[model samples]
Each structure stands twice: as C-alpha cells, then as structure tokens.
Target: MTPTPHDLPADLDVFLAAAGWAGATVEPLQGDASFRRYFRVRKPGDKTAMLMDAPPPNEDPGPFLRAARWLDANGMRAPHILADDAARGLVLLEDFGTARMRDYLDQWPDDETAIYTAAVDALVRLHDLPPGPFLNYSMSEYQREARLFTDWYCTARDLYVDAGGFSAAWEAVLGDLLPRQRPGVTVLRDYHAENIMLLGALEKQGLLDFQDALVGHPAYDMVSLLQDARRDVPPELEARMIDHYVRAAGVDKDTFLADYARLGAQRNAKIVGIFVRLWRRDGKPRYLELIPRVWALLERDLAHPALAPVAAWFDANVPTALRESLGGRFEA
Candidate 1:
C-alpha cells in the first residue's frame, strides 16, 4: 500500500522538506526485526534515497553512521550517508538498488558459488583491517548471549534449569574459544544473505544492517554468514566457503574450525531463545515457524567436540520433543 502523508511520522514531513525531497514519493520497504522503519524516496527527476526512521530511546542512527564510515574507509560498500536529523532519529542514505543477495540466489541457485565466493572474499578483506574504532566483542557479551537460551527458550517450554550452572558451562567453553579469536578484527555481526545486496557492475556487493558491527573473533562473522538462521546453506557450499575463507585468511585451520563450531552453537542457541521471546513476549508468533530450522542448526553446532559442556547442558535441560515443537504451529 502507498504511504500517504498521514502514514508517516510527524517529523518526517519537515525532515524531507528540508532535504529537498518535500514532494518526493515514499514507498515503504521491508524492514528488519528492529524498531526501525525504511522507505524508498523518489524525486521527479529520478533522484532517489533510502530513508531510515530510527526513533530515539529505542534506536539511534549513530552506530549505523559510524559503521558506514568505517566500512567505506576499509574499502567496503556500505551505503553513503546523504543527510541526517540526529535529534529526530532520521537519516537519508544512498540507494543501493533492489537486488538483495537472498532473492537473487532464490532466482538463480546455480550462481551460489559465485556470489558466496565474492561475499567470503569481501569479508576476508574486512577482517584483514585493524580493529580500532569498533567496540570489542567481549567474553561477557558472548556469555550473556548464550544465557538467553536458558533465560527465555526454556521458559517457553515450561522448564527451568540452574542459571548459575548454565553460566558456568558456557564460561568453560568460551574460556578456550575467546582467547583464540584473533584480536583486532572487525566483525560484522550480521553478514548473512538477507542483509547483503548485489550491486551489479558498480560494486561487488552492498552491505546493510551493520550498526551492530564489533571488533572480535573472525570466526563469528563467518559462521553468521554460512550457518544462517533464515536460510539453509547447502553442506557442500558451506564447506567450500569455509575452506575458501580459511585459505584466503591464512589462519590456523584447526583453531578456526573449532572456534567456528563454538561460535555457531553460541549464536544459534541465542537465536532459539530470541525466537521464543518474540512469540510469547512480543506477540509476533510467525517467527516460531523458524524454530525447527534453528534447532537443527543448533544441533549441528553442538556436535563439535568444543561444545561438549554446552551440549551436555542442552541434552540435560531441553528435551528433543520440546526442541522440535513450535508454539504457533501447534496453535494452528
């Protein structure tokens, strides 16, 4: 549906008018899980921009702007910041066009290797840079994320586990994994297909949703891309990408693989908790449908020897039946 004047935020009209797009057409765009809203703005003469509405107290454009500058400086293709009204929580960004990597791959599955290879190579380049200016992706941060599984997912199942015990189990696993994460590397926390865009001949790819970028383990971003929650990356392709990244980055293979598994399990576990939270707490039940896929991914990650302690915790606390069930699916 077309967004009329009344459909926009009160400040949006004045904000656009001040930016020379007062009369531009606004087309609502697909948004992420965050509170932010997005719109495609088009002028009469074909000038275009993407408007980001990130209301304050809940969301801000500062991290996004900083990340964009950092990526651009490091030879990456994050959207250029055109204008901003920081107080009103709005920013104008360069339009990277309409080809998301997810949709593109859906249409041409054969191009999987080509696109994924490009993505891996691009990420390798980003990882090679110095990690200053980005916030450290810390041990506490990792631990807190892992605990989200026990905090929310278990509650959804009407089960309870010793929170203190869970924290200790994660501490043991992360103690070994965290030190191995090559310090001083930029980790784009969400490097998955959906947040990546195809830029045709102009650029290899365009990045979106990088406000959460951090400086930490190289493996964190790699796992985020390969073991995506929303889509299944074929086993052969996942292996190829992992090998390609290992080769290009010139790192110890054994450590990288171990850390990949550790981090993968960590991320997927946190996502499981988050999915349940989204359904029961936020009243958004559609995400429950993805629980089975997420559970499968978590199982794959837990198979690694590095995740033994956490795996034991899961085996003891979360039953197989509970893991496979989705509240919304059952409700239907």
Candidate 2:
C-alpha cells in the first residue's frame, strides 16, 4: 500500500491547497514503524510545517489529532495541528525542526546528563497532570501484550514453554505489581529519545509518537526513556535520572524502582514479539537487528527481586543457553 511519487505529490498538493498553502513545496521526512508518512512543507514566506499522510485502510489520524489537542491544552510540547482531514487521514502539523534528540545526542554526548534530565523533567510534568482523555493501561491490557512474546517468538523459534505455568507466573507478577500502580499518570508508551525532539527550550524536548498515550503507572514512561530499546542508556546515568525524578516528584524510591523493573520487563517482552513479527510476517528484516539489545534489557529487568515469578518462568522455560542465543532471522 505504499504511495507512488505521483500519488503522494498530487495528494500533497490538494491537502496543501485546502490548508491555504496553494504552492508549498514538500520534502520527504523520515517515518516511523507505522504506515504513516511525513512531508516537510515549505511555502515562500511562511514557516515550514509538517504534513502527515496517514492513508486510510491502513492508518488513521483521529487518535493523533485528539492526542495533539489534548497535549496542547495540557501544557505539553506536541506538534500543533494546523488543519486535518480525518476521513482522508491527512493533517498539516507544526514542524519542530530536524533536531531529533537521538541525532542531537550523537553530536554532543557530553550533554547526556543535561538532555536526559530535561527529558525526565518533562515526564514528571506529564505524570503530574490530572487524569484526562486517554486509554487505561489495565492489567488485562498488560497481560495481553506480554502474551505476544509467546504467540510469536516462542512459536517461531520452536521454543517449548509451559503455557499454563507461564500464564500463572505472569499472573503472579502482574498481581503483585498492578495493585501498586497509581492509575492517573499520562504514560506516553514510546517515551524514548528518538521520539523526543531537542528543541533547546526550557522544556527541552518536543514530544512525538504519543498517539499511544494512556493512563498508567508514572514509572512506565520513566522506564521507556531510561531503558531505551534502540539505544544503550548508561547505567549510572539511568540511576541518576531515576534519583532526579524521585526527588522531583517525592515518590517512594524503592517502590518506584520495582515498578519500573516490572513494567520494563513487560514492555521488553512485548517488543521482542513485535520485532520478530515485523520480520516473519511483515517482511521487514531490519527490525530483527534490535532483538539482542531488547533481550538483554529484558534479562536485566528479570534480575529484579520483584520479578521472581516472571524470572522463574524464564528460567524454567527460556533457559540460559536460549536466552544467550538472542533473536534474528529465526528458521521455521
């Protein structure tokens, strides 16, 4: 369902004209895992804006527009929606420039502490907000997501696992952890550096990819930022940022750490399945490269004492040798 060059440009012209920019030229922008594509639109005498081409039958822009409006009203730095066609799945949005936090960090690795501190602070602000319009990160939701690891990776890899026991083990972990989560914090499910733009403002980062925002434990987004699947956040820096958030928010450090580890494992387990599915089903092989790092993070999270049940499941079913094998290009 990829758009041809002629189709995109023609659609872009129609969209731009409707948005009152009759002759704006567009340059392609980098896209994410979804089918949505972005274009940087430039008109002769106006500030550049972004056009999101979320084609119907595959992608939808309603949630994104709703999330953007909510974020704007709630004092977060999500892109402003200039105009949108919900039915066509097109939106003209404010461009936050090209300085993605990931690329910015590469140029100035020394700014890691400063950059991440600001990122964590933004998250603190997000968590502080009163519950608003968003989906709930429920226990059922968590378990359903975690099951993807078994549904895809375990099946594809021919990894034998005790299904009943695995479910019981997961239930034990979820039973302990879910009760402890405070349910109103806004969890931007993909709160990593790549989704954060280095705007160099007091808030420091402009948020993106937040259509999946939900009401969940505050620590969920915290772990997403610190324990990034795509990048290795230094352990010392991770510890320092956790402390910063703890002091800034005045939360119990021990409880928060345990929740962070628990959620991290759950998130990583889901990602392991997603990455494998991207390869085996979608035919996108590049995502397979990140599996090892994700597995390593999962292992780290499993080491936590709170994850005893989940850990035991892994130990009994996954095995040390299989854990070390990592995932990529799995044979049927």
| Top lDDT model | 2
TM-score per candidate, in order? 0.95, 0.94
Candidate 1 pairs with clashing backbones: none
lDDT of 1 by residue, 180-273 (tens): 6657588888999999999984238799999988888888888889998898899899999999999999988888888898889899889988
lDDT of each: 0.84, 0.85
- Give the per-residue lDDT digits (tens) of candidate 2, residues 160-279: 888778778778877776665555687889999899997756366799998887888888888889889888899999999999999999999998898888999999999999888887
Score candidate 1 by TM-score against the native. Answer: 0.95
How far is 50's C-alpha from truth in model 2 (Å)? Answer: 0.7
Best candidate per TM-score, number?
1
Name the 10 consecutive residues with the lowest summed lDDT in model 2: 1-10
